[model samples]
Target: MRTFAVLNQKGGVGKTTTAINLAHAMALRGHLVTAIDMDPQNHLTAGLGQETHPQVGIDEVLLAESDLQTTVIDARQNLQLVPAGTRLSEVEQGARGVKGGLLLANEIKKLERQDFVFIDCPPSSGILSMNAILAANEIIVPVSSDYLALHGMSRLMGILNHVEKRLHHKMTVWVALTRFHGRRRLANEVRDKLVNYFPGSVLKTPIREAVALAESPSYGQTIFEYQKRGNGSNDYSALADDLLHGRTR
Candidate 1:
């Protein structure tokens, strides 16, 4: 499986939204996708219309209490989900050290048949995020079109660099602009800066600010299901295409 960690140290950057929609978009294309909610907030679980507090979830898998296969729940036709259980917050306290960091990586080995696995990582760089980083072969950081959001990139890059150097595990990192407003000067400036900084690492599609993108999660549906012709759906579909075809630029 091509494992991806949809991560961002700073919150509200459409991280979970990207994870939910991107995974579903790939599933729409007939690829078997499994999305794991590694965030303790359970946004990904609730966004996908799954039970927020599952008996077994990613927390259980990381805790070694349950296996991935048994914890998997059907969220969409070809998109399966592993909900973030109630005790997910306790994982940081429960699982410590390097062994804890590798838990998700070890569990991911069981999903050899899956076409894609997207992990919705937490906002903080805690044990949960560490596990996601260690497990994923690719890292997708959603950079919202705002000054504060863009400012956090340096710190996030530092963390990624430290992880790569310390663990000697290199991952293909991609930056995706989210909540972008093409007409706005600030948003356009942010896009220009990102493209200049990341070069070919930046994705071609920028997820534009849209009501449908925000409203879909409340209805327990993706943008494609909520409003197929909307900008949100179009942007995500293009994003799926970009990733599928390795067209980052």
Candidate 2:
């Protein structure tokens, strides 16, 4: 199974949107995908149209009171979900001195038959985000097309380097541009700068700024289900294809 954590310390950058749509797109392609919502906000859960809360979720699993298999909800034919609740904040504050960084990694190992696992990390550095990075073999950092978004990437990379040294695991990191407007000169420049600096690490597709993406979660649907004709759907599908085929060029 390929484990990816969609993360950004900066909020409102389409991190959850990327996580949800990518999982949906992969499931649409017949890949067994499990989305683990590690954010206390639970936007990922609601976006997938899951109103029913599971008895146990990431909180219970991280606390070692419950396992992932028990908490996983069947989201779709090829998709599974591990929803998060407000108690997740309590777990984050208390998770310490117990090798908490590796808890999620241990829980993930118990899952079976999943082709892809996408972890929705919170928008801050904490025990929760640390556990996510430790668990994930791959990292997907979704950045807005704006200039300040570039600053966030530099900081995150430093953290990832520290994490790699501590965990003794090399994570494959990729940067995907979000909220991009191809018409904007700044957006095009930022994209090129990312590709130029990162080389093979940057995906070619940049998720364009779209109202459909913002409205989808409110309607409890992914972009593909919310508005197939929208740019959000097209961009995510392109992203899924890139991820599946490794067609960076």
Question: Best candidate, lDDT-wise?
Answer: 1
Question: Model 2 TM-score?
Answer: 0.96
User: Which sections of candidate 2 miss by over 4 Å?
Assistant: 52-54
Question: Which pairs of residues have clashing backbones in candidate 2?
Answer: none
Write candidate 1's Cα lDDT for 1-249 as tens digits: 789999998877999999999999999999999999998888899898886444588887777788899998988999999999888888888889888899999989988679999999989989999999999999999999888877798789889999999999899889999999989999999889888887888899999999899899998888899999989999999999988887876
The window of 10 residues in a row where model 1 has the poorest summed lDDT is 51-60
* Cα-based lDDT at residue 93, candidate 1: 87
Against the true structure, what is each candidate's TM-score? Answer: 0.97, 0.96
Model 2 alpha-carbon miss at residue 208, Å:
0.7
Clashing pairs for predicted structure model 1, backbone only: none
TM-score of 1: 0.97
